[model samples]
Target: MSKTIQMPALSPTMEEGTLAKWLVKEGDTVSSGDLLAEIETDKATMEFEAVDEGVVAKILVAEGSEGVKVGTVIAIIAEEGEDVAAAAAGGGAPAPKADPIPAKSEAEAPAAKADVIPAKAPPAAADNRVKASPLARRLAEAKGVDLSAVAGSGPNGRVVKADLEGAAPAAKPATPATAAPAPAASASTPAPVAAAAQDFGIPHEVIKLSGMRKTIARRLTESKQQVPHIYLTVDVQLDKLLKLRSELNAGLASRNVKLSVNDLLIKALGVALIQVPECNVQFAGDQMLAFKRADISVAVSIPGGLITPIVTGADSMGVAAISTAMKDLAARAKDGKLAPQEYQGGTASLSNMGMFGIKQFEAVINPPQGMIMAIGAGDRRPYVVDDSLQIATVMSATGSFDHRAIDGADGARLMKAFKELIENPIGMLA
Candidate 1:
């Protein structure tokens, strides 16, 4: 029998992606675990692999195709001893349904599918079976509409989003007037207004937005509009920390490990979060989550946009280990080869622009994460040492906190702990 291969969902948030390239062509033989193509997800470009051994009979989708939906057949393969021409002419046989990919963390999971409330009315289907697309299901649940009542307009009578338009939700019983009044609904962020297209007649080329760019634009806009931000700044002396880094690098020279200032800062932020647990939290609608361990997400600038690759358990890792891990993560991130788990979940974030000579700037908070620590360049400046003015190496650090979850006092305490750790330079080691 022939087998059909569909486009796989590389990440939990991926709905559609660009088929960047195909490694195998028609009539090529492939085995299990062989690289098949490169898929460009919103976060990264990941390589897809083959699971069955066969000969590539036909390519259903061409390379560089954009907006290819998940579960769409992309290619066909003929089994061993099967006629390639026949398989190609007949298309490919249907493959067995595969299990959905499991999410690595709660934050990465889709809340719409997990928390949907069922409608009160029974489904209209006589056989008690309903066929709908994932998007249609989500919309139906949100609107309290029964899926069986709606007629599908998609392939093979599959319900789609268009079918739910103008559909009313099932009615519920009204509360008694004598009972206590219900709580007011929370305020929602206003939807963005679309701008009218205009051309100034300038001679320029038009470039389409990539998936990564679109995601970045939407996420950052939502973060700024929804999250209430509180900014706190502190100047830390880096002379002692710099000296310690030199000594540690010399000791680890034989191990080929070199520690950057950013590595030490990552450790500091992780330890500080542990010390002041109040700062490590996420604010859900009705509850707050307090984490026991600290996972630091380090921001790396890629070709199209920025991605944060997480350094898990940064508090307990040694400086040398942190350095090694960061080097590998950054290298892979730039090449667009990081897995979803490597960049998905984190207790907090750390963004360093010291290399770009940025003195100080406030960073936008990544949602679900309470705070982000911004590091600035360390340069020579006038400082007060023991009530006397002296020149010292100083850097300005800013912490952007979500006021909904963390209070100003707790944010200050975290900043104090981070400053102490950096100044002493030995407390982190102990």
Candidate 2:
């Protein structure tokens, strides 16, 4: 019997995706666990694997096809020893596979290769009917370049204009035979460059947005428009926290667990949420839901936009544990290798732009998350100590809260608790 392969949802929010590339071709032999293709979802580009062992009969959807809806038939597989041509003609819903592996694992499994967009190979004759934008096709035709021999840079491996100028010379067509011959230049004079087609106008370039970039813009815009935000700002001294971190790191040097300021801040915010439970909440349509355990979403910037990977049960984890977990999450997040659960659903978020020397800024709340704390750079500034002015290292932290879910007093109280945790240092351990 022939088996149909449908486009599986790569993430909980995935509706459509770009078929980035195919790992196998018609008549290829493969095992159940072998990779078949790469799928580009809004969150990441992930590898898709085969669940049923068979011969690759046909590839229905061409590589680089974009906006492929979930469950769309992409390929067919014929059972071993069956004719590949017969299976190519067979059609129906990809019936349930006897393989015990769950369908959810199709997207949830760790990728064998972690790159979001790996270097594309110039298409071959077998893949000549590649998925590409109309513009790219026309440009390829005009340049006497074969679309099959050019690597695509657009979404889902679709060839774009940038590929024309940027593709290796060896991949493009030979220079036009009828063009005017260039005059040889002497050592005193350099040959003049030819004018471009658009030489009459100012130069500009167009950049197509990736799936991840597009989603980031849409979600952040919607959040700002619909969510009523109340922001509270505070300045806290960091000297005590710094001193405590140094002392702790020296004592635990043998463990090889070095805590970052952000890691400690995560612990502080997690503990603060537990102490002031009123602030640990999400805004539902009719009512607010308060959570018992604090799961912190720490924002880490990637190539396209920002992603807040969750630290599950952060309030219960020690600083060393948080450091180790955070490092792993950040590394994987950058590589587009994190699993769905690793980056989804959080009660609150923490965004730190201090690394870029930002003084302070308000962050839009990612809903159903009621709040996000924005951290600024720690810099030296004058402060009052027993009414005597002194210079100290301090940072401005701003908390953006959903007014519908939390009160101003409660928001202020949460900030006060966070301030105390950083300033006193010892309180975070307690």
Candidate 3:
């Protein structure tokens, strides 16, 4: 028997991916758990592993093929002693199975009446059932191209991948004044119109967007449009925290553990979320999810885009442990080797631009997560210490909360707790 290997879903939100490379070619023998190919999903480039032992009979999709839909057959594996040529010839798309209809019980069956005529579906409903290839449909969705408006060039007027190339998205219909206004654009919203480029004879290079960059653009646009963001900023003296970090690093010098200012702040945000649980929540339709433990997503900028690698149970982790974990996560994130689970879910997020000398800025809230804490650079400033003029190292921290799930007062309280934790660095350790 031969096994048909279809494209695997690399992540929960992966609809399609690029077959970056093939490790095994036709006629190569592979066993279970052997590396098959490198797939570039929206999040990362992951290695696909084989599950069954067999010889690679054929490769249907070529390397560097983009927009390969999930469950689309990519290759075939012929079992031991099977004719590879025969398997390759017969191993195209699998036959579509007809859905089995269940037999209705006599007591539950509705009475058939000659007078009851079946209602005709509207023209628009019929038009929505446009014939299109899976790749064409996926490309149309990403590019916001309307299949009904596109002129197909394939057999029987079926929409093909080439039909969507350079096709403009359909314009939205105008809404009537009497109708209620639609909500802000969300993840399900169609992609906005792309900005046209004009070089004006200037020498410039046009770089194609990678899968990661496309996902980031779509997600951040949706976040800003749909998520109601409420930013609360507070200035806290970082002198104490800085001093504690120095001492802690000195104590851990023998163990080769060093703590960065951001590590202590991550601990601070995690503990603050624990202290003020109201701020640590997710907004779902009709209900809100209150988290018991804080899983903090730390933002790391890579070549293509930014990624947040989560540090689960950050509240209970020590600064040394947080530093170690963060270092590992950040390195892996930059290498694009993190698993989907490592960057997907979090109770909240933390983004620090202090290394770049950023004074203060508000961060967009990652969807479903309640809030994100943005950290600014710490600098020496004149301040009143015990009612007297003094110099202190202070940093401005801003918390961007989802107004739908968290109240302004709760957000303020979380900021207050974060300030206290940073000021009293010993409490975080305790």
Candidate 4:
């Protein structure tokens, strides 16, 4: 009997997905655990594996079909010599029908087969291409200059009309016999022709949005529209903390552990969250959740994207352990190999742009997690200490929280406790 292969939930929060690509085709043999397609979910692009082995009898959905809800039958698998027609004809236990997401036509398919060669532009007007701006074309036609003779300053090397009218008139030699030469145009005067518009090379490159990126967009958009968020900002004094970090790094340098301010901040935040559990909370379904353990997500940015890998049970780990775990996670993050557990289940998050020299920033709270802390660059600035004006190391940490899970007062209290832990590094260790 043929079996219906429905789109499975690739991630915990995946409700709908995009069929990124199909590895197998109709009439192709498949196995119980063979990869069927790559599905782009809100979280990541993950492989969709077959659960029952058979020949691919029918394909109902094409690649790049987005918003396919979970359990939608996307394909069928049948035994050898099995009737594919019978399978597709809605016979034998009739598979549930999906509302049918419109599929892309073969001509519009994004994937190119290995044997396919892309068509090259004809070589004319070959060596030079024609690309003219509306104004330039109008001016060129009005001025009676041939656009083809003009070189293109536009993108993809297209000839713009400006290229024609702006062409420098050939410098003529002075002949004494002529009536007083019309006043020679001064070089300093601006030309009547408009300046060339900057060609930002193809308005945009079509990037296939990954599952996580899509999910991030949807979730953030929903958060911004539905969930009310309130932000609280606090300045942290880093003088004593900086000295402590230097001492710790010097002591642990032999152990191949270099402690950064972020590592310390993570440790401190974990401890502070333990003290103020109200901030370590989540609003899901119709219930409110307060977590005791702080699973802090540390945001890491890579070349093509950004991922936040969680340091689970951060409240239970020391600075050295946090540093070591972060090093491994960060390496994997850059290489794009972090396992699901490594990036999920965070009760709170920390996003630091200090090393990049950003003075201040506001962070969006990662959904479900009630709050996220945005850490800014540390700098030496004037401060009032003991009735005297003096320079001191200071950094700003802005906390963004969901009002549904935490109030302004709760946010302030949490930030206050967090500042103390960071200001006195020993307290975090304790």
Q: Which stretches of candidate 2 lie over 4 Å from their true place?
A: 91-200
lDDT (Cα, 0-100) at 104 in candidate 2: 20
Please provide, for model 2 over 192-276, each residue's C-alpha lDDT reduced to its tens digit, 9 standing for 90 to 100.
Answer: 1211222334453434467678678888898899889999999999999999999989977899988889989999899999999
Q: What is the C-alpha lDDT of each candidate?
A: 0.81, 0.78, 0.81, 0.74
Candidate 2 to truth, TM: 0.76
Lowest lDDT sum, 10 consecutive residues, model 1, at: 102-111
Estimate the overall C-alpha local distance difference test score of candidate 4: 0.74
Instruction: State TM-scores per candidate.
Output: 0.75, 0.76, 0.78, 0.67
- Top model number, TM-score: 3
Write one digit per residue (lDDT tens) for candidate 1, span 226-315: 899999999999999999999999999999999999999999999999999999898887899999999999999989889999999999
TM-score of 4: 0.67
Deviation from native of the Cα of residue 42 in model 1, angstroms? 1.7
**Candidate 3: deviation at residue 106, Å?**
51
Ranking by TM-score: 3, 2, 1, 4
- Per-residue CA lDDT of candidate 3, range 1-430, in tens? 7899988998888777888899999999999999999998877889999999999998777687666677777888999998999888774436311111111100111111244332232122243466555445556655557777776553345555656668998765566766568665434323422222221334434345777887788788999999999999999999999889999999999999999999999999999999999998999989999999999999999988899999999999988999999999999998889999999999999999989999999999988799999999999999887899999998999999999999999999999999999999999899
TM-score pick, better of 2 and 4: 2
Instruction: Compose the digit string of candidate 4's lDDT tens values, residues 315-354.
Output: 8898989999999999877765666677877999999999
Which is superior by lDDT, 1 or 4? 1
- State residue 417's C-alpha deviation in candidate 2, in Å: 0.7
